[model samples]
Target: MQAPQTKEEKQLDISLDELIYKVRELKQSIAGFIYKLENEYQHISWPNMMEHFGVLSSQLNSVKRLLKTSKMPLLRNYVLFPLRLSPDRDLELEKLTEGRVMAFSHEVVPDYLRTKPEPEVEERVQMMSVKASSMAPDTTQKQLTNLNKITANLLDTISVPSASDEREKDSSLKNALPQTSSQQDTNLLIGAITKGHRLLRPEPQSPMVVGPQMGQMQPQMQQQHPHKLQMPGASMGRMPSAIKTNIKAAATSHPYQRP
Candidate 1:
């Protein structure tokens, strides 16, 4: 008998052929997607939603195609994809933190702040301070009184005059000045005599010979006097003879008689 061809080998060969045809189809799809994306991106304005959305759509479609064509379950192997256990872990952590924050917010803090007193106590303190301020110091009052006394004493000292000195000055002026008319006349007569003596009878050392010459010349003066002519009373303006005789007698008795 000839050896039988195994059926398992036949199935393996068909599956392998099917996988190759799927890979070829995937390559063609990827090429068409790349061409379409490139054409749209180049023509599209940058920063537009359509340009970015088209790139993302192309990537997601490529990934789906790779997953569909491949034999391996690649979702289990990719670490960069956000479709794994990371989202569940993040959600669980956020829920736990929120619950903890709410519990803390509801808890109460202790009351440490204090309050002040009433208005009555403040008024009582102010009244006591006012009463204390009204009192005075004994020493300061005494010092002010002493200062006033000293000022009065200084005024008294400056106002008093020297009585005895004033009296002495007045008495001395009285003694020095002339008192009566007779004393003044005597003073005038003495001054006249002093001046006449100075002119007529000089000192012992004088160049003039005055005293004896004046005495000797008196007798010769009588003879020269009779020879000098005298006017008769009748020749004068209406002079009587009796009146002329009286005038001659008065002239002889007078101290100023010439001869």
Candidate 2:
């Protein structure tokens, strides 16, 4: 029988045939190295790496199917060359295995069909019923009332300031008052004394003219006696002396001391 084929078909067949040969060669080389490690480098025998190789074999089979399905020319070559050469034994491979195991347990395994019965929902419902049965229908209202009472008590306790707080507030107010009050009182008393002095002791009316008349009158008025203005025959000199004496007596009579 003659094998009839197109140019594309022949090329495809040739590539596929070459890929199969390379795959077989790669598997043989890998098996030979694994045997050598097991017998000779037994101490460094990577059971884990070997396990990965088994998984890698399965991956290669998957790649074989992919190559057939996709008709990609280069996939087999990429898979084959590395398989023929031994990989370095490293912790990276161990970590990969750990990750794969984790993925299997956490992501892959749980998604697999679960045969175990789930009693959690039923148990939760039953527990809820049991709790419900243990309490009266009015229990929620009673609890609400009790909670309100507790909250009211808590708020009252917080809102009402303690004795210490009140004392501190009062003390703060008292301390603040005296600092401002004493200074204000001193200013008020000084102002009152100045006002009273202006009212009771009016200055002599300024001389109408600003020349010698005022100047002459200023000394005369300063030298003039107070009793002459009010008494019958006292001299201006005696009047001033009496006014000085009377003013000193009046100043001594006042109870308030000068600031």
Clashes of each: 0, 3
Give per-residue CA lDDT, model 2, range 1-259, as digits (tens). Answer: 2355475566667777767666766666677767767786756548856875776577577656756765555543433222222233445544855443332223333334344435897788889999978888699779989999999999888865553366677686665445555765564456436433111222224324345444434444443232223212222223334334577677876689475
How many residue pairs clash in model 1? 0
Model 1 Cα lDDT, one tens digit per residue, 65-168: 65566453333443432222221234454575554322221121111111334578889988988876665767657878999999999876665434334567
How do the predictions measure up, each by TM-score? 0.17, 0.21
Q: Which candidate is the best by lDDT?
A: 2
